[model samples]
Target: MTREFTTPPASAEPLAAPPSRTNRGLLICGALAGPVFVVTVAAQALTRDGFDLRRHPISLLTLGTLGWIQMSAFIVAGLLTAAYAIGLRRVLHPGPAGSWTPPLMGVFGLGLIVGGAFRPDPALGFPPGTPKGNADPMSWHGIVHAVAPPLAFAALVLACLVIVRRAVMLRQLGWATYSAATGVVALVLVAWPGQDGLSMRLAVAVTLAFAWTTMLAFRLLPPAG
Candidate 1:
């Protein structure tokens, strides 16, 4: 008898595995973390008394009776970002990005958590009734908090560059350029000096950083097919 051959039905193709499904959910959390944190802080800045975005650092929101809101936002966003990094580590298997990006992302998340745990000292006339001058002889907690943003921002910047490295290896020049610019601009903004509108610069720098994170999450979230 002649051999008979049969093809499997279209619907019989294997579906996405469980870990992949979990990763999608986690990536979505990463994508949303930046927006949630920024929106929460922005809304508070607009409404809270003596909180001028042009003058005050966003961290100052973590002061006064309403400070708890910002602290919660920080911790929650950080946890979500950490989850995002974990998902990325599992799925970004094609390049060196898989090696470096996740750990840097984790560092950024941890920095945020630490920053939330220790609010920065009041300065530049924020929280109403506080002195317009800087917080001299700063509290131990405030000093610790001061270290978080720069460290977090630096980690995030490195993460951006790491993606660039992988993109270049894959010959994705446009993606590489975009990633490089994002990292460089954020670093420059954060490192810029001068008091005039320094607060606004910091705000913009952070927004750029967070926006990059959100967009990168979306870009990498497509499932393997």
Candidate 2:
């Protein structure tokens, strides 16, 4: 009788890493949240007369909460964007990826911060005649609000372009395509007439779109597969 060698059962430790399903879900949620917040803010701005911040203190309270959420979204998005950069660093030419990383993320983060400062609040209300504040020629917040979107868009555009280029070089077709599409959509949305225009309604819509896309892209960075 041949003595059959008994192989020990596999150890409890995983040999291969598990897929980041949870991470992916978190990313999707974050992305969706950004857009949702944007839509909420925009809706409020559009219906400013209807939204009495003073009478319904709850609504004011709600706006404050949403603002925090918006800020959180930016922080999360920046982190995710950084992670994507790291992944790209693994595959791309050292010099370009290295050079692009800091400034790209730096500006993106700056956009979020500045954008936060400029975010319109009907509750606080800007100087008279400046609807959405970004359209306000006289007020400083208006100018900041006006300029912030473009700056944020520029940063995003750069980051996305670099990622796409690196993806192309590395022959990462899927990653490249997605990055490019996201970048393009974001750029277009930010630069669109609605955003670029001085119209308050359009500006609000564009800003919302910007926030949404940024969140969506950032979330995808972690577990897009």
Candidate 3:
């Protein structure tokens, strides 16, 4: 009897090992991070006694009697995102865009945790008790709080670009365009610090960025085999 050899079909990406339950759980956390954060911010922005998304940035929610709520939200979201990054490596590895994306995402997640740990100084008359025009002589923690978001945003933008490259390589023009748009728009929003609409702009940027992350996580989720 004669035996014949067969080969698998050609593809852009190599098939990854099947994901275990732990990895699936991590991806689920990644998917939930966006909703958990966006909802917390929206609900607090709408319900807080003096909070106003039009004027007060979401960071101010980390102040006052209800401060812990926002703080917890940030930390939780950060943890979820970090876990997702770990899971992302499993599926994205041995492929394009795998080198920098996961580390960048981890950096972004760390920034969130730092921002939560070091709350910004109350400003713009938020929490109904602070004077306007920023806190005087800014606290060290406040400075760290100020620095975290931009750094985090920068990392996210870089990660977006990396993914865009991957998408283009795979001939996924639509996904590439979407990733490019999200990255560029987010960068612009982060750079602009206008007094009139800073809060609104940041809110939109945050929602958009996290939405993209959630979408990416779902798209990369391994199939049942």
Candidate 4:
């Protein structure tokens, strides 16, 4: 009997390459940024002398003998946030939301770094020796620090709006609503004029915004190969 020529099974198409190690690392960095920042600040707030969560800001922690610790925390958190922004750029689907969100977040991170580098003026009776109710005249660094947080907050709010659009596209109504609400609440809290609770309100605002950011990083994690 004549041997029939047999064709080898068609080679399977090559699988797509897995995500890069760099990408994974960036995602991890992003994921850790919020928690690291929150935890560091929380610890300092709880233990540091002359810190009043109701009257003084977390930023004021940059003024005392142990100020270096808070400053370092700010710098480190900013770097991690920037790294996550890169990962967002890579992982998000192409669109207006995707195009703008990463840059906005990147700005937020840069602002944090800049704000840390330029410490705020002593105000609201911090550092144990300053006047209890009077804020010092704005120093150059204080002016810069004052500007940075608002700018960063603006960028973060814009990014949240952009993310709302994307969430709607994904048919996630809850996320979309939450995103928009987060922005609105942050704006309200930040803009509130009551000095009595300003510190606490601002802390809440920061927590809400960064917590949203951290959640986003978790959402953007690439699927395991």
lDDT for each of the candidates?
A: 0.84, 0.48, 0.86, 0.82
Best by TM-score: 3
TM-score of each: 0.88, 0.49, 0.91, 0.88
Clash totals for all candidate models: 0, 0, 0, 0
Superposed model 4: Cα runs more than 4 Å off: 1-18
Per-model C-alpha RMSD = 5.4, 9.5, 3.2, 7.2
RMSD of 4: 7.2
Candidate 1 lDDT (Cα, 0 to 1): 0.84
**Number of colliding residue pairs in model 1:** 0
Q: Rank the candidates by lDDT, best first.
A: 3, 1, 4, 2
lDDT of 2 by residue, 39-122 (tens): 655566455444442232211222343446444544454454444333333322244444674456556556655655554444
Off by over 4 Å in 3: 1-17
What value of lDDT does candidate 3 attain over all alpha carbons?
0.86
TM match of model 1 to true structure: 0.88
Report the C-alpha displacement of residue 219, candidate 4, in angstroms: 0.7
